[model samples]
Target chain A: MNLIAFAILALLAATAVTVARMRDLWAAIMFTGIYSFLSASWMLILDAPDVAFTEAAVGAGIATVLMLSTLALTGKEERATTRSPLIPLLVVTVTGGALIYGTLDMPHFGDPSDPIHLYPNPSFVEKSQEDMHGLPNVVTAILASYRGYDTLGETTVVLTAGIAVILILRRDESHPEQQESP
Target chain B: MSIEQVVGLYNYWIVVFLMMTGFYIVIARTNLIKSIIGLNIFQTSVFLLYITMGRINGGTAPIIPAVVADAHAHAHPADAHATDGPAGHSLHETADELIYSNPLPSVLMLTAIVVGIATTALALALIVRIREEYGTVEEDEILELDRYS
Candidate 1:
């Protein structure tokens, strides 16, 4: 089990690095799909099957297709940035180090006694069954009932995004330049 | 601190590494599509981190019992033995005995995944419009062209 987890992590790391380094936009897009797939597998190992399902569907599936469509609209090859990569590299290093430092205070992975698992008020893992009216899937209960307002807001955001995209792209399509170029 | 602590927290280190790589990609890559991919990678790594935090090593998925044991209890209130005996299971016992994985983070991340995709769509749409207006998706090229125009 540990070996499998480590291997998935390694694969995720390797994919992320390759995506970072590769200048070919198409290959990088494919690698991003691979990265999402690996993370979904990791989510499965972590017992978040729902999250894994959503990630696989949204991240690897829909996002990739949208990216491909965008690629169709835009250039295929990425022009190498003439600016030095040093500043970004340094900034990422500092940010990563800070995040690692933050994790030191976090509860260890799968620790049952962790506040999220054992705590009663907000985490809701403890009394989700009772509080949510005997709904077996606590995630569903929490999302649909307990946190209904948040889910509603998320749905609204999605609707707004769709509208915004249509409004912007529809305007672009009427342009003579786009028709002439392609 | 110790080997045990490091071993237990190794998952977090992996999360950090993935986060950094994604962040670097977004910053360093000039292609609009590739930057969006980087953003996707960054968002996905975050979901992994949240899911990892909620896991229990030996826990099962959060699901209700297979059979409706409560109906039997209702039919024969006097003989409460069915609820406890080997023949039939108790409704409460299903929840009480099982060490179910935490579902809260999974729920939150599900919404996040949806939002992430929506944002990606919007971003791609904007990239398309940018390509139409500026005739290029590379940041440097767009900046140069826009400045001259």
Candidate 2:
């Protein structure tokens, strides 16, 4: 299990780096899809099957399609940047270092005694069984029932985004010339 | 660090590295679409971090077994007398036997993954509009155009 986790993480890191470095926009988008798929697999290994399903569907599937369509509408190759990369490298290094430092205090991987598993009374797993009356999938039970309002809000956010996209991308039939030029 | 310590913490370290790679792409690159991709990379890494935290050493996914859940469903209707019944006893035993990974993070990330895709779609729409208006998607070119005009 540890070896599988390590290998998947290494693959994820590799794909991320490749996405970062590739100048071809199409290849980069493809690599981003690969990265999402790998992460979804890793989430499965972490016992998050529902999250994995969502990530695979939305991240690897929908997001990639959206990006490819955007690429079709825009340039295919990234233009060479004239600026030096030193400052950005420095900033990322410092931020990554701080994040690594923060991880030192985190619980070891898969430690059952971690505070999250113990806190807030009976834990979500047990509480969910009681409240949901033996729902087979606890994650879905919590999302659709216990945290129903949050899911409603998420739907609203997605609705707003869809509306926003329509408004932004809609061609004005009254100003065909404007659409033609700019 | 010792091998155990390294093994314990390596997942987090790699996640951080993946995040930084995305951050670097966002800040260092000038392409707007590429920035969106970078944003996605960053978001997925955070999701990985949360899911990793929720894992238990021997836990399965947080779905109860169908037989146990069916027993639970049936046992609930006869609650007054079910306490002494075999169905109720088996339900208790099954709960004790199963170790499930934390479900809270999975719940949260399910929402986040949807939101992330929505954000990506919106951002890509904006990028397409930008391309239509400015004739380029490079950030520097857009800035230069703004500066001159």
Candidate 3:
């Protein structure tokens, strides 16, 4: 398993380095796929089959397709050859390192006693014993009923994004004066 | 001292690395398309985090096995007043493997994936329009032109 883990880590590192060095937009997009695919494999190993599937389907599939299309619309190469900034890099590195150190006490991966899983599933599952909402699935009941407000907010966000996308894409100024060819 | 622990321990760090790399690309890259790619990677890492937390060890799922039910019958020794008759048994793996996964996160991830695809498609459509209007997609150049206007 560690062998597979190391392989994934190395693959991701390679993608990162290639993304940095690749000047061609097409090449960069391919490397981005490599990065996402490796990440999905890691997700599978993590016992998160659902997250893995989404990562594979959306993160790797839909996102890559959209990016390639965008690249077609945009110029294939970077427009400006600006020098890199070292200060921002250093600052970001230090801040990220500090944050990682702070998380050192986080529960080890898949610890049975981890608070995340053992927190409250049984209590919620036991909810059927009381109210008799006739819900077999504790998760479904919790989201659709117990915390319906949050789900409503999420649905609203999704609908709003769709509307915004339609509005932005439909903004076509059709009446333009024709200028004579110079 | 088994296969589970090894796969389990390193699973999370891989997610973190991929996530950080993706985030760095999103922030530092001037290309809008590249930033979108980075965003995908960032989201992928998050999905990995959610799924990895759901793995349970040595637990053959919550479903009841037929053999275990049969054993309970003999062990009962003809006790007629047994309230719990191994109801969790006779459940095949068809119930999505009743392993101890918090289905809430999985369901949320599905919604998020749909939302992300919609957002990306919309963004790409907008990028096409931006190209047609501005005749270029470079952010710095666009900013410079906007400043002059």
Q: Which candidate has the top score in DockQ?
A: 2
Tens-digit lDDT string for candidate 2 (B3-82): 98787888899889999999999999999999999999999999999999888788899898887666666666654232
Worst 10-residue lDDT window for candidate 1 chain A reads A120-129
Could you tell me how far off, in angstroms, the CA of residue A20 lies in candidate 1 after the best superposition?
A: 0.5
Task: Give the runs in model 2 whose Cα sits over 4 Å from its true position.
Answer: A177-182, B70-94
Candidate 1 residue lDDT tens string, A122-150: 32443454455556676788889888999
Give the top-scoring candidate (lDDT). Answer: 2
Q: Which one wins by lDDT: 1 or 3?
A: 1
Q: Is the docking of candidate 3 incorrect, acceptable, medium or high quality?
A: acceptable
Candidate 3's C-alpha lDDT?
A: 0.61
- Taking all chains together, the TM-score of candidate 3 against the true structure is 0.72
Q: For all candidates, what are the clash counts? A: 0, 0, 3
lDDT of 3 by residue, A1-182 (tens): 85896788788777876776566888888887777678767656654454566677777776777777677667688654484746546655775576565445556665556666555433343332223333444445555676678668767877887887778767445644432211
- Give the better candidate number (2 or 3) by DockQ: 2
What is the RMSD, in Å, between candidate 2 and the native fold over all Cα?
3.9
Clashing pairs in 2: none
Candidate 3 residue A180 C-alpha distance from true site, Å: 12
Q: Write the per-residue lDDT of candidate 1 for residues B63-149, one digit (tens) a residue.
A: 545343244334545543323333222222344466677778898999999998999899999999988877888888888887887
